[model samples]
Target chain A: MRKISAEKIIAVISRLCIQSNCQINEDLITSLKHARGKEQGRARMVLASILKNIKIAQREKLPVCQDTGMAIVFLEIGDKLKIDLGEFLSLSALVQEGVRRGYQSGYLRKSIVEPLSRVNTEDNTPAIIREKIVAGNRLKIKLLIKGFGAENMAKTSMLRPDAGEAGIKRFTLDSVKKAGSHPCPPMVIGIGIGGTMQKAVSLAEEALLEPVKSKRAYFRGCPGLKSKIKRLEEELLREINQLNIGPAGLGGETTALSVKIKTFPTHIAGLPVAVNISCWANRHQEIIL
Target chain B: MKTKRIFAPLTSEGIKKLETGDEVLLSGIIYTARDAAHQRMTKNLKKLPFDLKGQIIYYTGPTPPSPGKIIGSCGPTTSYRMDPYTPSLLKLGLKGTIGKGERSQEVKEAIKRYSAVYFIAFGGCGALYSQFIKKTTLIAYLDLGCESILKLEVEDFPLLVGIDACGRDIYQQQKT
Candidate 1:
C-alpha cells in the first residue's frame, strides 16, 4: 500500500482551492469563444463582454466571475493506496481552511450557511466531497466551484422506457427555457442519462467536469453504451442551442455553450435523465497525483 | 414605449415615465440590500438604522473588493429570492427595486398598489454595474458578513423596468 501524509493532501488541495477559485478553465473559454461566434446581436455582444471580463479576471487572478461557487470536490482513490481516514479529514479540514483564507485573503464573499436559518458560516469551509474507489494506486482530486445561478436551475426526470431521445431533448430544452435568464448564460449543459434517477444526476455532475465539446464529453466516454450515446448527445446539443434562447435569453441566438451527455445502464423500465448546468464562468480545476 | 431616469426617493413623475421595455439610465443615490438585509430592515422599518422610505434598493450583496477597489463585481442577485421581504418594504413606500429576473405575483401587485417599479439591471453584468457605483459605504448588518447593507452612490446606472406600477409586467407584456 502506498502511504501518504495528511499534510501533503491538505497542502495540495489548499493550493488548488486558492488557484481554482479564480481561474476559468481554458477549454471552457475556448468553447465560449466558439459559441460567441455563432451568437447573434445582443447575445453575441454580451458573450463578448463576458469573455473579455473572464480574461481580465484571469490576468488579475480575481475569482473568474463572482458567485465564487459551492466547492464540490471529487476524489478518486486507488484501493492500493492506504491512508488513515482520520488523517484524510484532517487534511480535508483545510479545504474550508483554504477557502476561508482564499476568500478573506482576496476579499471574496463567505458563502456557506446554515441551510434553513440561512446564517453565514463566516468562513467558507466544510467543502463537499464525493469519494470513489478505483483500480490504481494514484490519488486524483478535482474541484468544481459550482455557482448557485446554475445549481438552482438543475433538473432531473425519470423517463418512461418509451420516452426515447425525443423526450430527452424536449425535457432538456424545456429546462433551459424555463430557466430563462436565471442561470446566467451562456450555459454549459451537463446531462446525465440512464442509470437510476439519482445515479443519472450524479453522472450529470461528473459529466460537467469533462472537456467541452470533446469527442470525449463528460458522458461521451462512458464505456459499454458510449458509442450509442455519442450520437444522441450531438443531436441533443444541436437542437437545444438552436432554440435561440440566446445568451442570457435576451433573444438572439446561442443559448448553450456545449451540451455534454453522460449515461449508464439501468433497469429496463427506467430511462432517467438529469441535467447540471454551469454558468458562463464555468470555474473548475483538478489535480491528480 | 416608456423611458424614465428616476433617482432615490422616487417621485410620481419619475415613475410615470417608465415603460416595460424602455432602456433607462438611472442616477443619484440607491441603497444596496440583498435578501437577508431586506428581511432585517423590514422587520424593524420603524427602528431601522437608515430610513428606506422612497429610496431605491439594488438587490445585491457584493463581494468585498480586492486591494484598491471600492467593490468587487457588484451585480444584482436574483430578485425573486427577495419576494417575501419586498412587499412589506413597498408598503412602507420603498421607491423601487433594481435587479434581474422575474418577480413574484405578490411583488408585482405590490408594485401596482404602491406605484413602485421593478427595474432589471442585466444579470451577470457585474463589471458594468460596478462602473456606475461611484462610492460604497457599509451601512448596517456589519455582522451579517457579505450579506450586510451597503449604501452606494451611483451615477447613471442603466436598467429596464421589469414591472410597472399599473400592474403591467414587462416580462409578461413583452412575451407577446
Candidate 2:
C-alpha cells in the first residue's frame, strides 16, 4: 500500500490554492484567444482586457479576480492507497487547514460568510469537498475556485421525462438569456441531466472540472448514450453562443465558450436538469499522487 | 472607439456629458464598499464613515495585497445587490458608483432623479484594475477585512458608462 501523510496533502493543497488562483489554465487561455479572434466591437475589447488581467495576475502572483471564491476540493482516492490522518479527524479537516493556510499566505480574499449572520469567516475555510474511491493505487486532488457571480446564475428544473433534449435546450437558453451579462460571459456552461435534483446539481458541477475542450469520454455509459450527450453538448454550445450575450454581456456571438453535459439514469417520472455557469476566469487545478 | 477621460468626485456637469456605451478612463479618488459595508452603511446612514456627496463608490472586495503592492486584485462585483441601498446613497449626493452588471429599474430611475451615473469596470479583470489603483487607505469597518470601506486613489482606471445621468442604460440597450 502507498502511504501518504496528511501533512503532505495539506502542504500540496496549500500550494495548489495559491497556484490555481494565479495561473490561467492554458486551455482556457487558448479558448479566450480564439473567442477574441471571432469577437468585434465592445465584446472584443472585453476579451482583450480579460487576457491582459490574466497576464498581470500570473506575473505578479496575484489572484485573477478579486472574488477569490469558495474553494472546492475534489478527491479521488485509490482503494489500495493508505492515508496517514495524523492528528486530523478526517481528510476534510486537513484539506480545510490547507485552504485556510493558502488563502492567508497567498493574500487571496476570504469570501465565505455566515448565511444568516453574514459574518465573514475571515479565513476562507470550510471548503466544499467531494471524494470518491477508485480501483487504482493513485490519489488525485482537484480544486475549483468557484466565484459566486456565475454561481448565483445557476438554475435547476425537474422536467417531465417527455421534455427530453429539446426541453433541456430551451431551459438552458432561457436561463442564459435571463442571466444576460451578470455571470460574466463568455461562460462555461455545465449541464447535468437525468438524476435526482441534488445528484443533477452535483453532476453539473463535476462536469465543470473538465477542461473546456475536454473529450466527453470520462463518464461511464454506453456508446449510444455517450454520443447523444456529446451531440447535446455541441448543440447547446452553438445555441447559447447565438444568444448574443457575448463577452461581459455587451453583445457578440461568443456568449458561451463551452457547454458540457453529464448525465445519469433517472426515475421514469422525473428528468432533473441543472445548469452551472462559470465565468471566464474558470479557475481550477489538479494533482495526482 | 475614442475613450473619454474623467476624474472622480464627479460633478453634475461632468456626469451629464457621459452617455451609455461611452468608454471612459477614470482617475482620482473613489471609495470601495461591498456587500458587508453596504449593509452597515445603509443600516446606519447617518453614521457613515465617509461623506457621500460627490463621491463615487466602487462595489468591490479586493484580495489582500502581496508585500510591496498598494492593493491586490481588485475589480467590480455585481451591482444589482446594491440596488436597494443605492437610491438612498444617490439621494445623499453620491455622484456615481462603479461595478459590473445591470441595475434594477428603480436604481436606473434613481440615477436620473439624482443626476448621477453608474460606471462599469470590466468584471473579473481585477489584476488589470489593481494596476490603476495607486493607493488604498482603509476608511471604515476594519472588522470586515476585504469588505472594509477604502479610499482608493486610482489613475486612468478603465470603465464604461453602464447607466448615464440621462437614464440611458447600456445593459438595456444591448438586450436583443
Put down candidate 1 lDDT per residue, B91-127, tens digits, no spaces.
8778789877778899998999988889876555565
Instruction: Report the Cα lDDT for residue B135, model 1.
Output: 90
Runs of candidate 2 exceeding 4 Å displacement: A218-222
Q: Write the per-residue lDDT of candidate 1 for residues A1-289, one digit (tens) a residue.
A: 7886565666667677667766667787787788778766556766776776666556655555556667788889888987644433654564555555656676666778899988788767667888889998888888888878779999999889899888888899899878877777777888898888889999998888878757874333346556556787777777767766667556555677777887777778879999898886666788887
Cα lDDT of model 2 by residue, B71-130, tens digit: 999999988889999999999889999998889999999999999999998889999899
Query: What are the runs in model 1 whose C-alpha is more than 4 Å off?
Result: A1-8, A79-91, A217-224, B1-6, B164-170
| Residue B111 accuracy (lDDT) in model 2 | 96
User: What shift in Å separates residue A234 of candidate 1 from its native position after superposition?
Assistant: 2.5
lDDT of each: 0.75, 0.91
What is the lDDT, from 0 to 100, of the residue A223 in candidate 2?
64
For model 2, report the TM-score of its A chain: 0.98
